[model samples]
Each structure stands twice: as C-alpha cells, then as structure tokens.
Target: MGQTVNLKQRLAYNYLRDGSTKFLCYGGAGGGGKSWLGCEWLMQCCYFLPGTRWFAGRNNLKDSRASISVTFGKVAQWHGFTGYRLTNDGIEFDNGSEIIFLDLTYYPVKDPLYERFGSLEFTGGWIEEGGQVNGLAFSVLQTRIGRHLNDKYGIPGKILITCNPKKNWLYDLFYKPWKEGTLEDGYAFVQALVQDNPFATEDYIETLRNTNDKVTKERLYFGNWEYDDDPAVLCDYDAICDLFTNEHVKPSGVSSGSADLAMKGRDRFVAGHWKGNVCYIKLDQGYSTGKSIETDLKRMMIECSIPRSMMIADSDGLGNYLESYLNGIKEFHGGKQPINPEFDNLKSECGFKLAELINNRQIRVVCTDAQRERIKKELSVLKQDHIDADTRRKGIISKEKMKEILGFSPDYLDMLIMAMYFRIKPVPKRPKAKLGDI
Candidate 1:
C-alpha cells in the first residue's frame, strides 16, 4: 500500500520532485508531518534512484535517532517497504542506495568550516529541525550533496529542511524573503501549521493550545515568526532587515571605509566602503594572509577615492599587519575608552550607535544576497550585556560571548560597528570657573 500524506506534505513533495527547485523548507509548526514527509521522501528515493546516496541530519545523532529515525521506522512500516535494513550508521537498501545519518551541530573550535563532511558525497539529504543547525554548516552541507549518482539517475540533487518557527538563518533565508515575494529562484518555502495536519493527536493539539508560554504557543500553534521578544535585544529584527532597503539614507557625506581582518580560527576578512551612512561592501572572503587583504583594501580605497585618513580598521590581531602597511589610516581599538562616558568601552559605544542607526533607519547597506544574509545573522546577536544590573556600565555583549551564540566570529557586524567610529563625537568636559570670575 502507498503511504498517505496531507495536502501540505503533498505540496512539499511537489517542490521536491520538481527539477527546478533545489532547496525546500516544508513546515513551520509542530504536527505538520515534517519528519514523516522527509523520511518517506528519502526512503522512496533510495528505492527509486538505485546507487544514489542520501543523508538525514539534525542537531545531534541522539536527537536524529529519537525523532527522525523513529519517524522513518513508522513511515517504512506503513508503506510495507521491506527492501531496506538499518545499519550501524544509517539505512542500506538492497539496490545499493544508502541513507547516512549525520550530526549537524555547530562546533567552532573543532569544525568551524564543517570540514569533517568535506569528503562526503551524496545525491540528496534532509535536515530535520533545520533551525537548530547553523547557517555555515547548512551552507557546507549544500556543497556536499549532488555528488552521487545524480547524472546516472537523471535527477536533480535536492535538500529538504523541516523546521518550526525560529528566528535564525531560516527566517533570514526563507520566511522573510518568502513574505516579501523576493525568495530566490530554485528555493521554495511551504509553511504548514498544526491545524493543517489532520493526523495530529488531539491531546498534543490541546497541550499546545493550553500552554502558558506566549512565545511558544505563538511559534508552535500559530507558526508566527514575529512573536519573539527579548529584553536584551538592542535592535528590532524588522529594523535590522530594513537596513538593506533604506533608500533614504543618502550617500552625500564623507567617504570612508572600515575593515575587520580575521586573526585566525575560521574567521573571514570583511571590508566595506561607505558614503555617509550608506555602506557598500567591497570584500568578504576567507583570510589566507594579510597581503591579499591589504592589496584588495588599497584597491577599493583608491577606486572609491577614500583616503587613508578617513579609513578605519580594527587594530586587533591580524588587523595590525594590514595597518602596518597602510600607514596614516585611522586605527580603531575596541578596548579603549569610549568617546561617550556612558558606554563601557569603544566597542560598546559603537555597537550601540550601530543599533541606533539601524533602528532609526539611518543606515543602508548594498550587497549581494549571501552578504545580506551574513550581515543579518551577525547583527541579530547585538544585545545589551548585564541589562538588569544598574551598577554595571552599559555595554553590548562581548565578542567571545557572541561567538558562542553565533558559532563563529561576528566579523561583519564588528566591521559595521567599527564604521560607527566616524559617527561618534567626543563629549566635551566642563571647565572649572576661576575665583575672580565667579
């Protein structure tokens, strides 16, 4: 007997089956049969596309076994497909097609570039709980697929992601763009809520309805993307997203540039040229040596007519190497005292100023989709540190903490924040009155 799927799952299958669509996001809420659809799709493909390889990935292997693997078992039994058996790592079929299970957790120190999967070759894959995976991991996974038996089978390589509402990369890469009708070609998003799933348990539905957590209810029950609210958040998500479309931020003022050169550990070198508040990214690539960045940056400045007197680069780590060559360029040290006494340090002051400029729609960024997504991911982590402690000086969260949360260095946001150095004015001190004058 053939397995049955709801209309929403069927719609996702349509995208998966299409030759044009390469990436697909199936669901946005619980009980939408996301796992079932993903498992069944991979299973059927394993049988149909003989000699092909596939992967089923999640945040961890244990979660994949407990959730996605269990769902695969049920889906297999329901269809009465007995041609496959579970192995130590994954499922292997009689036709030689295999479905490998993978742990897609983001560990910066161990596998910042996800090079562990560098040699992997797969025809397609599914990422369950896609929101839990980091953007860089997903990006690397995309490259690994479409390398196994695709030409032999006459099928396009596809990667399906199943997720609930989350304000991570999925939101920036899918939901927001889908809402704006600007999602790129070859990518598709199909949102399905609990109500759309007919097989959902009544008890589970009732539990979701009865939950007291407003954010959880809104996310799981209604699939709302805008329900999240955190006190420490310095800028609104919408405002951060609007930075790319702020056409009113005219480019009429001083021409300047900012660069954040990576010292090491999988961080990239990022540089941007600016005309007043409008930023135009010139370079964003992995660092091999300071020579390449220095050459590229000098070219950009010369091309943009930006002088070394107006250019700024962080004087930390490898940035010093770039600065040593480009003499007369302004240097920005994050640990130095802030021009504004209210901020804890130079970095904190600029971070807050960047957030203000974003929220006030005073900044505009011109870049490609990949760059835009990276910028959004970086700035989304800009939040106040010690928001509740009145005794502490006002400061944004530290780079180490941001790295922990983002799974990588926030080079883009750091460069953008460093650009605020030009915007900050030194606060004047009041002079003491003379006795005779008084």
Candidate 2:
C-alpha cells in the first residue's frame, strides 16, 4: 500500500544510513510506516553488504505470514530480492543473505523460555509488535546481534523495533528514558502519531475517532502514552479521586488489606494496606524476581507498617511463589466461590464490591497524584461480562483479557480489590429470646 516513504520513515532511514546509532526504534501509532522502515533498512544493508544475514518476525508466526509477508513482497521486486522463497515461516534472498522469520511464540513467558535464542545468531533483527516480546527475550536477542555478518563493510550490528504506544517492556526500556531526556547513547526513538502521517485516509481517521474511550482515542489516533480503556470501567475515575478530598473522614482503628504479587517481568508485586476506609499503596513496582519480591515484602512490612495477617496475596500464576515465601499472608484465589449470587466467581465479587465501595464514598486511596492517576487508569479499564444464559450469569473480565487490552496485567487494581474486599463485613443476626415469652 505504500508507494513512497513518509517523513518519519525518512528520519529512521537517515539514522540507519548514517550509522549514527546501533539501535533505532521507530513508529508510535499505526500506519506510520514502521514495518516498512524495518524492511527497508534490512534491504539497504543487504544491498551494501553481500552475504548479509538478518532475522525478521513478529510474536505470532501466523500474523507474520499474513501481514509482514505482503509488506516485504511489495518491495522485494524493487530491491532485487525477487528470487526469494516466500513462505509462512521465512524468506531466503538469492544473494546468499537470509532473512529468518522467527515466531517468538516458540518462547513463552514463564521459566527459561528465551534461552532458546542462544542457539541462533544474527547480523541484525527487527521485532514487529515489539510490545509482545518480553525484556528477557530482547536481552537474549541482543547477544545474538554482533555474530552473523562481517564488519569490513562498516555496517555495525543493528536491532530495529516497531510498535504502537503501549505501556509494556518497550515503554520502560525505550519510551520512559526517552521522555526523561536521558535515553542512553547508541539508541534512538522516533514517535509518529496518526496526525504525522499525511497518507492516513479520512475513513481510517473516522474509525479511530469513533472509539469514544479516552485511552483508545489517545493511543490509536493521538498516539498518547496512557492506559487502555475497555468498555466496562469498574469504577468512575473522577469519583475515586474525589474520595481523597473529603477531610471530615477519619481513619478507622482497624488496619487490614490484600496484595497481588509477581515474582518478575510483566506483573508487579503490589500490596494495598487499609486503615479505615482508605487504602495506602506500599508496593506498586516491577522488574523483580521471586526472591527479590519476598525480600521487598518483608522490608515493606517493617517500614510501611503493612499488617501481614490481614493481607491476602494473589495465589494464582507467579503469585504462588510469593504466597509460599511471604510468611503469615492470606491466599486469594480469584476463581474460588463468590460470596455474592450476582457474581460468577470471587474475582467478580471483588470487582463489583469495590465498585460499591467507591460509589458510596466509603473508600479512599491515600497516595501521590501520580499514584492516584495510575490507579484510576487501571480501574477505568476493568471490564465485566454478562453471559446470556437462561439463568443470568455475571463475571469479571479475566486477567488475560485485561492483559490483552492494557498489554500487561492490572497489578494495582487487583491489589485494590483484594484489600477492599478484606474490609467487607459479614451480615449480623439478632439474638433469639428464650421461652420466657410463653
């Protein structure tokens, strides 16, 4: 679909052409010619240096065949790689240079999945949908960078990535530092929103406009760095912020809460401690391992005063490791039986119950504006489902769905739910009088 490269594409090409940097991460929004930049850069390298080798792929092999194949095929004729063998798996250039298409799905998230990359080497590579690949995978890929091609041609090993504005490992690795003006040397990031692409059609622009959700609007069209908003938001973000403003409310004497734990990568080890109606977030960070989170929990217990007994930590997924290590902490299984009839499971009950608390002005979150805003963003994307069965069935959106929507797990919101549900009181009954009434 692209006959000519745009301005942002030219900028990335210049960086690669000049050999000004070893890494170039391009494109922020869709239709900004990011994938094109990756392919073009590969073509330029192959043209200049004979027998050059490269690897190009996305997280899903099937998607690679469907989308990237067409993008590469369109330019293969112009670049004289026309004798290539194109398939669902890879493309082989006629010049003895190879572009191996790796389905990174070969490496899953848990355990030592990315270690498989140690078996292969490449001169350079490009990761499409860079958000899907984890940091560990990227780190391993970095080792394979300088191994595949010759240096006599003056083409240094390069790694290019293309992705939308998603808050994932990419955000932490590239965007955050870039935003802070402290992005390390030898790396560059070029952000191209939809407005930057003059080639964007009015019809496509209208489609992005129809998405009324704030995060979706900011991301797909405006390409702003913000949370992804689903159709069903558990709580009103404005209402949650308002709770912090009411000065008449006092902290209750009892102190309790719950936690959502992650050993490392993707999820965070988060805990929210409740003092009366307010929840204070003591742990909401990432880039850790099983051993580190346990240590952090123990340290936070002493420093932040988090009551160990009252906090119920998530017991599913990696949280199992956290539960076993954190002494005296309660375990919360989201799939367990729900206390309310309207909910399909304990997780659903927790979400709806937290919504009730927020709606009634019965809860508050004591934190910095940034913390509150982050919590609100996570809360706003919590979706719900109503199964159309003969008997009504209500369920909270699975963490997997939330992950797809936000590009990562909702750690803080899960902690918030667990903590508030811990404070839910059981119903009471009046004492019965003896037979003296007779």
Candidate 3:
C-alpha cells in the first residue's frame, strides 16, 4: 500500500498526471511543503516509467546535496525504493531511471549548459530554486526535455520548478508566465504557502513568521510585492521627467560614466557619457579579456575626453579586481590613484544627494524613451526604506511593488540605477581654509 499523501502533494500529482503539462511551478512562502511535493512527484515519475531519466537541480551543488538529494533519499526509502545509490550528486533507481542533481552556480554561462545537457535528451527535470536560475539558463534547460516518447514515460516530458518569490530576473520567466494565465501553452503553476499545509506545525509556521523581517513578511506571508515601507528613493521617474520638461531643473555640470568588467565567461562592457545634463551611451558587446579591460578603459576615457581621475567604475564583487587593476596602472603609469570609490556606499550617498537636488529643483533628467523606460524598469526598484512612515510614504513604488502590480522582473531598470549611482558626487570632504587666514 502506498503511503498517504498530503494536500499539496496531491495537487502536484494531479499536474503531473496530465503529461501535457510541460512545466509545473510551485512557489511562495517557506515551509509550504513545495520541496516535499517536488521530491515525491519526481520519485513517482521515476517509479512509474521505465528508462525515464530526470534531473533535480538547485542554485548550488552544496544545496543540491543537502536539500534535494537528502529529501529524495528519505522519500525513496518510504516508497520502497531503498536500494538506490546516492552518489556525489545523483540518485540512481533500480529500473534505469536516474535523478541527476545539478547546480546553477557551477555554470554561470547561460547557453553552454543547455548545449551540453540538451544533448542528453532528459525525460524530465526539476529546478529546486526557480527564482535563482537565469531566464536564459532556465530556457536552455527546458529545451533538453524532448528526446524520448514511451507509453510509460509519456510525451514532451516535463519540468517541475519550486521557488519562493524574490524580486530578481527570474520573476518574468516563471512567475509572470503563470500568473498572467499564458502558462496554459506550455506550463501549469500552483501557489503554495506555509498556511496551506496542515501537517506543518503551528510553532514552525509562527517561527517563520517571527523570523521574517518586514519585507519578508510582506513578500512571503501575505505575498505582497510592493515597496516595503522604507524611504531611500530620491527621485521618481514621473517627477524627474516632469521637472526636466518644465524647465525647473539645474544641470549638475558633472558627467556620468559606467563600467563593465570582464568575468569568467563572455563580457560586454558599457558606459554612458553625460555632460550638461545630456547622456550619450556607448556599448561594447563582444569578447573582452582580462588584459583588455585597461585598453577598454583608455578607449572610453578618450571617447569621453575625461581625465583618468574623473571616471568611476563598479568595484564590488568582480569589480574589486578591476579596481586593483586600475590601482596598479596608477602606480605604474600615472603616479596617482584613480578615483574608483566603493560602489555601494557611493550609490547610497549619491541617491541621498540626488534626492536633495531634486527637492530643491537643482537637477533635471531628459524624458527620453530610453531614460524613461530605464527608470521605470530599473531605478524604481532600487529604493531603500525610510525610517519615518511619512517619509517612506512618498516617491514612486519599488520594483517589488511593480512586480506585484505588473507580474514581471526588472533587470534593465537595475542597470539604469547603477548608471545613475555612478554619476553621484564623490564623498563630501572638509573644505580647506586659506593658509594663515582664519
């Protein structure tokens, strides 16, 4: 006799029953039993179909080992498939179906993994953290599911995805598709929250509730994706554009610069040059090597006709490497350090300054289609909460807000925020008094 299933598990089972369901997504609050449902559903697929091959993946291999593999191990044991071999990152079943565990962290490049894995023609798959995988990566994985067609295994295969809502790029790929009712073409989505599971202990649910911060509480529990009651946004797109067009704005007289450093895979460098309140963007979307970034910077400097000291570069994460490289160049060639401040701190200070400038009618932005779209999609999402409720109450809604309202992720808008942040004034310094004149 099979073990009795829970309500959430039954929903997942029903979705799996319709072999036509190409994609199955279950997401929302934590402790919703989404992971458990996913494990049991995958196991059942492997059990019922001979020669069926499935892959279960997460954001990282370590997580795959600890969560997906471990959970599936217990489920397999309960379901009488005890002799399966749990290897480095996979579980092999007795009847030739295998559950291979993979991670996105191992492969950041979006398309290559698809080319490599898509060749295998997997019968089915599951993405554990649907929120983390890039849309391109998820799309690539989806292509790999249609090689075999047996009566037992069904046709077109299927993919099971599980996630909690996060305001990242993946929102458009999975959440929006299903939420908008367009998923009927190739997918079916089901929302599961902690409150939906009866077996989940009240204490556990309350614990999650207690531990969740204000943002998490809003996003996870209530599924509210609005601007958290925080204040940090300095300018609203509508206001910026309005002020610029109405002539109630001042030009900062400072130019803007953006930098993209090369990483492990393909690198596309972009920078925008602004002067007297006009922006001219330059894009370099091609192969860039580690040795060529300096050359690229020099070319950008020439194009903008700005001294090396005036340009600002992103120096967080891989950006640190670029910073170190520029510092090395200063020591060897220029005999002075280039001004590349810590991106995050600089961004905050710039945001604050921009807010002040906007409040005083000292700055203007052109409402160009590119600029408006970028602000609506990117800058709108970059706000941090203000401590005072009254203060936080003002300004445009955040990306999370837009996601709840619009049902899509904002990536291009984020890049626009970075561009704006790069142009903010350097940290204020104490003014020097004239020598001997107090």
| Candidate whose lDDT is highest | 1
Q: How does candidate 3 fare on TM-score?
A: 0.59
Instruction: State the local distance difference test value for candidate 1.
Output: 0.87
Q: Any idea how many clashes model 1 has?
A: 0
Candidate 1 regions exceeding 4 Å error are 227-333, 336-379, 384-438
- The segments of candidate 3 whose C-alpha lies over 4 angstroms from its true place after superposition are 1-6, 77-83, 106-114, 149-152, 225-376, 380-428, 431-438
- Over 1-438, each residue of candidate 1 has an lDDT whose tens digit, in order, gives 376989998899899999999999878887888988999999999988888899999999888767777888899899988898887688899999999989898787888788999999999999999878887877998898889989887888899999988777788789989999999998999999989899999999999999997767888898987655456878877798899999988998779999887633368888999999999999888744667778888999999989898899873666566668998888888989998889899999999999999999999999999888778878878999999999888999989878866667898998999999999888888899899988
How many clashing pairs per prediction, in order?
Answer: 0, 0, 9
Model 1: ten consecutive residues of lowest lDDT:
314-323
Q: What's the CA error at residue 49 for candidate 2, in Å?
A: 1.8
Is candidate 1 or 2 superior in TM-score?
A: 2
Top model by TM-score, which number? 2
TM-score list, all predictions: 0.63, 0.69, 0.59
Q: Candidates ranked by lDDT, best first? A: 1, 2, 3
Higher TM-score: candidate 2 or 3? Answer: 2
**122-202 in candidate 3: lDDT tens per residue?**
777888877666555567777777665444444667888887875454455556566666654666777777788777799
lDDT of 2 by residue, 1-438 (tens): 123677887787776666657677777776676776777777666655667778887886787776778888767765555656775557766677777787666433454457667778788888888866655556678788868664656567778988888656677667777888988888888897767677678788888888777667777777765544334555655566676765555677667766787655656777766777777777776777777777877776766566767767774665566656776777787788876666788878888878877867777778887777567656755667754454765777787766654556778888887765575554565579789965
